[model samples]
Target chain A: MNYTDVFGEPTRGKYVIAGINVGMILRKDWTTHQQARDYLCDFDGEPQIVEGIDDEFIREKHKEYPHLSLADCEYMWTGAHFCEELLKFDGFMLHASAVVYKERAYLFSAPSGTGKSTHTKQWLDAFGEDAYILNDDKPVIRLLNGKAVVFGTPWSGKTDQNRNAGVLLGGICFLERADENWIKPVGAKDAAFGILNQTIRPGDKKRLVKLLELLDNVIKTTGVFRMGCTISTDAAIMSYDAMKGETRA
Target chain B: MKVKSDFVLKEVAGQWIVAPSGDASISFNAMITLNDSGAFLWKTLEGGASEEELVSALLGEYEVSEETARAGVRNFVEKIREANLLDD
Candidate 1:
């Protein structure tokens, strides 16, 4: 399964993601991005598997989203592997729209087509200069010294919306569409179930252990909530107010 | 009865979460969270313990009486069995 033999010397690039230097080997058609390229250095990155990824694995992933190009599948495969590796550093990626307001990051996670983007857009419109999308999709969370921190990454879906930023995670809210806007606090146990749907689960038992441990810290250290919202600025403000721990007037 | 190999239990932040993994991961959406006593029964059942054996372990581990131990083991065993997480 040595990819170097199958495809000539893979494109090796070092990039800092989630504040960890990763020397990722991208094969044939997989691509890199400028966002991470800014953090390039000679510092040694962790060594990871470059050849064990199977064709059946890529095809199975592609079957879930057929619109993805071969290159997208290749890159997605690498991203999943990076996430698996990120587990060791107390980090893992969440499929969420992370927004930065007042310098703190708030992540909103949900299943696709669930208006995760539309709701976050309301935050942008509501707070023009004060709010920005840190990563529109797939932001990385790392528990640093018992504090949850969210970091922007290059593989931010098709929107390409991301910042080379790491902000203290303020809260993580699982979003849902509702006729009216409302928010409520969620316990850590319930947060685990909501989070499991949005994050990549590793294949083996050992890494799965790391993931659960990190997940425990992330949920415990940050505020977790569930919000039923509509695509309105008021809904955004309501969620923002609750997540930011601001008192309602 | 015994716990299936498809499921793995681990303690995270003093809580026990049981989730299906490997090939059985895709088809199920159920995840079981257990307390200290439930986790003990799960670890014991991993090697296949009888109902009486589970009750005895519960009695020995905690300072509970026989009736309470029997009820605790009964309730915990029924739950895993219902979740199909046990190989009975």
Candidate 2:
């Protein structure tokens, strides 16, 4: 079945995500989600067209995830297709709340409902003008000139907080709820494991290899920390101080 | 028995990591790290070597005795088997 025949004239939206130009093509009937639309930008140069998943594949996915809504299916298809295209340009999506602080990005990653967003919010509240949300969720990390930089994506989670800018990744912190605030440096192996847990691992073998390699480089270049804390400004300050080497306590 | 086809061994930052790929990675849900001896044995076992061959290879590379090599290989194999990364 021809994609164009089924979806009709596709609505093209161009976005510059993580320094790469992406042109999203979808059925005109289906509107781009608001989260992604917020980051949309005009791309003057040649853009890579991210075609929507074919109907047959969508049917199979619907069968696999019977409870998903039509909108869910469309979002999953578009995200998967765009991510696959982005991988070709050495970019991969990470499930984390990224905040820009002191001209660098610090990513807070944890399982859903584990307070990643809350912790980043604390950072913003504490730092005031010094910190801003790069992306509340699903930021794209790309390897540029041997540095792992984080860029805001349209797929930012619930808050829809994101900017189209990119920042050099300075650190990553895995959050765990605890009685008191504390932070410690994590080893490379542990850091990789945390990153893998938060990253969207592709099923394709070639893409999976690239993901693993990129993750390794990210761990090697960026500071990794494991923070245990409660929901307070102290949690944010403790982590920030540890990461910045301002204080050991 | 051998290391499963779906698992790939990667050396990152001077450490060895075994990561699942393809469909297995989707459900495997975990990664395993191997020490120097485990990495050596894993690479050796990729060719489907025997226990005795593994012990011999271990002794050739390290300063351990035959008995130590055998014990190390047995322990490594047992750990991988528990992780379901070996096709026995």
Candidate 3:
């Protein structure tokens, strides 16, 4: 019942994504101002949602309360938005979900309703616990020591699966709904565009270029792919193989 | 203006190339090289090379006489300065 205690459970995992130690706290509810404050302040996790009668509900609905700082509220929600790890791991967060297979992580990127969650679930069921979801909604990626590493985060769009960070990145897969499933290597320009499409940041041309630079480094190292698939693990498996190469360790 | 004496240069992240003690870091996509005269002028600017010293070094290293070196080095030093690749 203690949100803070759950979130601030000593961060026993190997890595901490965003601000929350995602390992201990799966999909759960936090329902009081004290609980919300404790949860937010404890691990410095952002307050993602104050809904479901948790804390700070001025009215009976999930709508924003006027007295509450909407700006701060939104900020709180995104506190643990992505992998903000490693000192200068300058990278952008995308509207994507990723899974870790072996030591390498594979990213399933898309805007909303583009089958990110559905594909992630397929990967999980297909690979079972062998594959782990980084963040189903807002996954973070950064370039560190000249490499792009993906981090597991706490923000899930009603997703139940939870864990700490993953290892290095496998590859980035930009999803497209297709009649049949197929995977293809993305060209450098297309790859850059794919990354850019999912990029989340406020900016002008200069900032966008900076983000592009970070993304360029990621594509240079991680490789990008375009995947067309039906709602089946077979497609997920194909996407995985394209990113991960052969099956099994 | 240029420095006087030995300066080393290095490039980082396809961005800038700079000397350890040099006052500037030059960013160019292509590799920048210095000719004998330019190298000599660059060398003379070791302890913060000056425009005159750069010319003198160019004269010493190239076939040009001191006067020509002075003018050429002066122009070249201006370019280097504009590129933000050298100390004043």
Query: Of the candidates shown, which would achieve the greatest TM-score relative to the real structure?
Result: 2
Model 1 Cα lDDT, one tens digit per residue, B1-55: 8998767787655568886666656644557899989999999999888999999
Off by over 4 Å in 3: A1-88, A204-206, A245-249, B1-88
Can you write out model 2's per-residue Cα lDDT over A1-249, one digit (the tens) per residue?
A: 345455345566776666777776555555344555655689787886554555667667888899975546666767766766777878888789998888888888898999989999999999998899999978888988888888997667656688889998878899899998889888878887787777776766567778778877777777889989899988888888777632111
Query: In candidate 3, what are the lDDT values of residues A1-249, reduced to their tens digit?
Result: 233332222222222344323223322332212222222333444433222212332122226555544323433343433322222247567677877777787888887888988897898889887877776766667766776777654444455344456467788889989999998887655665565456543223344345556755676677678888899989878888788752121
User: Chain B of model 2: TM-score?
Assistant: 0.91
- Prediction 2 TM-score vs. true: 0.89
Write out the backbone clash pairs for model 2.
Answer: none
TM-score for each of the candidates: 0.86, 0.89, 0.53
| lDDT of candidate 2 at residue A121, scale 0 to 100 | 93
- What stretches of model 2 exceed 4 Å from their correct place? A1-9, A27-33, A38-46, A54-67, A245-249, B26-30
- Across A15-44, the per-residue lDDT of candidate 1 in tens digits comes to 676787766655543544334455455665
Q: Higher TM-score: candidate 1 or 2?
A: 2
True contacts kept of 3: 0.00
Question: Candidate 1 — which residues are off by over 4 angstroms?
Answer: A1-11, A25-66, A246-249
